[model samples]
Target: MTGWARSPLKSAAAWALPYWTRGEPGRETPSDLFRVLYLGWAVALTLKVLGSSWDVSWHFKWLRDDLAPPHLINTVGTVIVVALTIVHGYTGYGVDRTALRLIQVGTGVFLVAVPLDLINHRVNGLDITSWSPSHMLLYIGTALMIGGVIRGWFVGAPEGRTRTVMLGALFLFCLENTWFPSQHQEYGVFGIHAWDRGEPYAEPILLQFAADQMGRSVDRNMVVAFSLPAPDYLYPVYATAVCMLVLVLARLMIGRAWSATLIAAGYVAYRVLIWPLLMVADFPISAVPFFLLGAAVCVDLAFYIKVPVLRAVVGAALVTAGSYLSLNLQHTLLDSPPLANTSAIAAGGLLLAVWLGGEWFVQRYRLRGQPTGARVSATATP
Candidate 1:
């Protein structure tokens, strides 16, 4: 390897990028090849995660003229996925299991979704929110993209770093997907007016509702006209539910050092990476720390509990509580307005979701590794 490639920062950068795989070409193992390809795909997914909110905010700030900056980035991400599919998705290549088959299907749906989204915008013009009937196609495509990766994860005999890293990438991407909607609650400049006084729980899209991007005149009437359905409470609930679920799954699969902590780390790293961009754009930073660190610490401690059920109980509580407190504290430090609903009603429900998800992870994921006859009922540890 060259000196640049050897540096820790450079090495991390290279691994994250979609770089050429050198050496004797075909001489590389399938595991090595898959790792390179999946990491590259991960890069594209990261762009999508980043762009999810960026796209929304861009439209709020400046109407789409002609696939300018945000749209262009969106194209780059889609193109990366398309190129990945073309390069690795050869006919009769190894991915044929029922579960893994979705990889090809997802790529197809995502392809279709792109043109449909463009046409949707063309026909209806840009709607207020991204959840229009056609825009939902994008979610469908992206969901399948994730589904394919999750299924492909176990299609064949176990691989090494390829599967391991992909699992981490999956956790990271899922975290981003779960957390993206929180942007609807607060983000950059547009977030300042994200909530309404009288109907706070509804969580209306107030950006561009009254004032134009120029920040001069106000039209309070437009708030009613431009308003869309945004249930704020569900934002954290859903994000936490999904996040807790995937992180648990990641822990089950990887069995590596600091599994949960690293999951939190990935969440933090992505937020930190984007903070500068928001700062440069003159938007208030609203990315709340998702409390992966505290959850991680709690999960680690949970391993020491002797009873399986008790361990899970203790672990889930610690993680959820730690994460909630961490986020509130972070928000306080930033002086940003707190999330709309942070009560135990929401937190407890999220806690239940994480516990249930952890239980499911231990069951479904564990089944694969053990012998068929040795199936589990309640015989697993946290």
Candidate 2:
């Protein structure tokens, strides 16, 4: 198992070292296989989006009207895209790390699975249930991508307190939209409400209304649709304030450790709160918390966790749980809708309080002035 795992790392080093050391900066962008894979996946998603939009019955009627040979084009296109993504991720890029490679591969697999599941849903009329394979795949893919970006690509180290703080902040920012009600009511981005009210191609017509209106008389349909009362915007404002406060607390407590924690906390909070709201509300916005969070967490964990095995386990578990919670929280919360998951919520609050309190304690003790290994390392590393 170890040998098999290490193979990708050794191969990546052999492939990347020469290019990284010798490649000219402006001559051409360095060809990281993962980047190529990312592009390929993006292209696939674009195609899927196009196909889905064109074939409205697949979405609205939930019937595979374009079920003839032409469907093969979509299927084949999807399969090829998924295959490329998996291959790209499996082959570690620009770094020789077995664990990271595995994560990449897993992420690729999940990415591939999302489209496949959607395709299946279209073809077979699968009951769109929460926690379905497709849904799980989407969540997993999101978490992996966010973790990777934050920990692997940006922060360079995940375990450090700085990385954690930064990650938390980022999460909060991305998920901030969740606390707010869907903007679809205000902007006819998706389409006019009539279009949503069984009106065919309401979105295109709404767009036309915007173009025609050009700040002229507002379309009555658009106005009425968007005019529905929603929760006070102040709630999100307050949430944002609280989120920022948390980041500030982390910064004061962790110092250089602030960045990573902020990013992580922000990412987690967004995924936990915002993304699901948008998706559940069926707003026009794309839910991308997973992508951001996955990239962030992967990079963060890489730097933070010293023990490889423990890092892998904890990172994987958190990614999975976070993704699940983020993706399905609306359904879970709305369906059963716990008024009091008090213990869990309380635990989280306690942890935050302790973390903040410790920061205060350390400051009071003048730990900043005291010569400690972290301080010495911080000073010496730069």
Give the best candidate by lDDT: 1
lDDT of 1 at 127: 58
Whole-model lDDT, candidate 1?
Answer: 0.56
Models, CA RMSD each: 8.8, 15.7
Q: Least accurate stretch of 10 residues (summed lDDT) in model 1?
A: 373-382
As a whole number from 0 to 100, the lDDT of residue 329 in candidate 2 is 58
In order of appearance, the predictions have TM-scores of: 0.67, 0.32
Error of 2 at 296 (Å): 17
Alpha-carbon lDDT, every model: 0.56, 0.38
Q: Give the TM-score of candidate 1.
A: 0.67
Superposed by TM-score, candidate 2 places the C-alpha of residue 162 at a distance from the truth, in angstroms, of 16
| Per-residue accuracy of model 1 over 75-103 as CA lDDT, tens digit each | 78888877766554442222333323455
Q: What's the C-alpha lDDT at position 108 in model 2?
A: 76
Best by TM-score: 1
lDDT of 2 at 46: 41
Residue lDDT tens for model 2, 1-382: 6998899999877875554333211122233543443445445544543343223222221222335333554455467555643443343332223224434654576658756876876754532222346745654554444333322222122245443444443334323322222222222222333345554333444434443444445455544333322223322222222332333333332334335344555444533454355446453322222323432343344336544345444443443333334424532433211112223333334334444454455456443211232211112211
